[model samples]
Target chain A: EAEVAQSPRYKITEKSQAVAFWCDPISGHATLYWYRQILGQGPELLVQFQDESVVDDSQLPKDRFSAERLKGVDSTLKIQPAELGDSAMYLCASSSNQQGPYGYTFGSGTRLTVV
Target chain B: AQRVTQPEKLLSVFKGAPVELKCNYSYSGSPELFWYVQYSRQRLQLLLRHISRESIKGFTADLNKGETSFHLKKPFAQEEDSAMYYCALSSFGNTPLVFGKGTRLSVIA
Candidate 1:
């Protein structure tokens, strides 16, 4: 039962400050994803990565948000000049296959709050 | 665009009662459907997928292609079954999942 690990379970940052969240996917997982879950809403995809290359980031706010999997084993998501509306639960997930009946494994998520 | 729709925002049922969480989708081609559950103080995890066709924790969902629906159901609900359930859809290949607004199930004793 390997689990995805996330750092900084809870974070509070001032508006205009930078915030970053880290995620370490399960060993041998090739695909990783970053999602944002707003209160009372389902999680939305921010970015998807296969190994170190990005597969899809159409929904990601390129101006303020960026995600990278430098080594492909772990990944980081950063928001520059965080805004109040950016407060949400950032989730990370990993899977061995791109699409299959065996779904991805998700992390506990990092709760972000901007003041 | 692939989309998943979970109609009810919240569903409350008594323990030992049958439970059903409705879900519908809109996809042009064949898509994969999944049910993810998040318990209190726990991470989101996969409950079951339509492709598997296997019941988990007494829960099962049948994919109805004509109606474009994949609803999650259980014969008898338990208190521990209370959680937030999300319906997700994904196309073939390395596509990101599109999730619905989820339904909160409260199995009251």
Candidate 2:
């Protein structure tokens, strides 16, 4: 089955350091999402992209976090000056369209730990 | 604000027994609800959705707007059913999904 791909399954960084994660959604998916999941907590949406354009980033921390989907096919999420509280699993998901029988397919996630 | 709530964080049941994972949502509009499952060492995947109204792998979820609940149920649990289940909701106006904390179901044989 086609699945969402993510890189750097695990990362350990010092506070204030930089970190970048990548995700490649399933082919032909129009919507992509970035979610941050802290231990013992639910995943929170940081950003949503629709065909290379950001549809929503209301919950994204603009000052420290930046995400891009230049071609609408693959996406990258970066955190400059990472904080200890920023440690969590970064999950990327994709959907074929706005709605259907199918729902989102999430990646295994990249676990980032900032010391 | 739209939100999802899964009351129990951990649920333990024996194999061949019934299982139920409760979920509630705080939304005021027509909503699209979904149940997602993540097994050990696996990525999260869709389990079922309210729109389809079809049972999958002996699992079923009914969306109750009046009570703002979408509970997942299975008549008999299997060892393979041990996993983390999340309840998510998508509002009528937005495509972004709001997920609950999740319930970790452990089927002990």
Candidate 3:
């Protein structure tokens, strides 16, 4: 089975530090998403990208968070000056344009902890 | 705005017992409903979708337009079914999914 790849399974950073997470979606997937899952809460969409163009980022904290899919294949999410409240699991998902019955395929996620 | 609601935060059931995870949504237009499951130390994956109308792993969900609900149900629960289940909604366009708080289902032997 083709799986989305994420780097740095776990990351711990001090407040005011910068952190970045990488995700490589399945081959040929056009839609990619970045979501944040807080403990005891469901995942929340942070940004959505179709190819290299962003489709929706209304929920993303533009001041501190930014996501990009430079090549329209792999994506990277970065948070500058991470805050304690930023601790959560960052998940990446992908889906082809067809997007049959089943929804997007998710990555294992990168757990971030800011102290 | 599209939103999904899963009232129960946690549910416990014994193996071989029937189980149902409630889910409701608020959407103006026709929305796509999905149930995603996350097992211990595993990635979140799609379990079923209302559009498919196919039972997977003995679990099925029916979309009720009048009540605006899409609840997941299973005839007989199994220990392996213990996991966190999330209900999600998506609109017609290429929009991001909106997920509910989720329910932790614990199927004990």
Candidate 4:
């Protein structure tokens, strides 16, 4: 089975430090998403990308967080000056297209902890 | 706003017992509903979608438009079925999915 790849399974960073997470979606997937999951809450979308162009980033915190998919294939999410509240699991998912019954495929996720 | 709601945060069932995880949604337009499951130390994966109307691992979900619900159900639960299940909704088009808080199902022997 083709799986989404994510780097740095766990990360611990001090406040005011920068942290980044990487994700490589399955081949042929066109829509990629970045989501943040708090300890007790469901995952929330941070950004969505259609190929290399961003489709929606309304929930993303622009001041401190940034995400990009340079080649429309792999993506990277970065947080500057990480805050304690930023501790959570960052998940990456991808789908072949906007249509179809095949739901998104998610990566194992990168667990972030800011102290 | 589109939203998915899973009323129960945790549910427990004995092996061989029937299981149902409730899910409701608030969407004005035609919506797509899905159930995603995450096992221990595993990535979240799609268990089933309302569009498919197919049973997977003995699990099934029926989309009730009038009730605005798409609840996951299984005839008999197994110990391996214990996992965190999330109900998600997506509006028409290429919109992103909105997920509920999720329910932790524990099937004990």
Question: Compared with the true structure, what per-residue lDDT tens digits does model 4 show for residues B1-109?
Answer: 9989999999999999999999999999999999999999989988998888999999999999999999999999999999999999888667888999999999999
Off by over 4 Å in 4: A98-101
Pick the winner on DockQ between candidates 2 and 4.
4
lDDT of 4 by residue, A22-56 (tens): 99999999999999999988999999999999999
Give Cα distance to truth, residue A80, candidate 1, Å: 0.5
User: lDDT values of the candidates?
Assistant: 0.93, 0.92, 0.94, 0.94
Which residue runs does candidate 1 get wrong by more than 4 Å? Answer: A98-101
Q: Which ten contiguous residues of candidate 3 chain A have the minimum total lDDT? A: A95-104
**Which residue segments of model 3 deviate by more than 4 Å?**
none
Which CAPRI category fits model 4? medium
Model 2 has a DockQ score of 0.60
Evaluate model 3: give its TM-score: 0.97
Q: What digit string (tens of lDDT, one per residue) describes model 2 on residues A1-115?
A: 9899999999999999999999999999989999999998888999999899999999999999999999999999999989999999999999877553255789889999999
Worst 10 residues of 4 chain A by lDDT: A96-105
lDDT of 3 by residue, B24-102 (tens): 9999999999999999989998998888899999999999999999999998999999999999998875677889999
Alpha-carbon deviation at A31 in model 1, angstroms = 0.6
For residues A1-115, what per-residue lDDT tens digits would candidate 3 score against the true structure?
A: 9999998999999999999999999999999999999999999999999999998899999999999999999999999989999999999999988883255999999999999
For model 1, what is the C-alpha lDDT against the true structure?
0.93
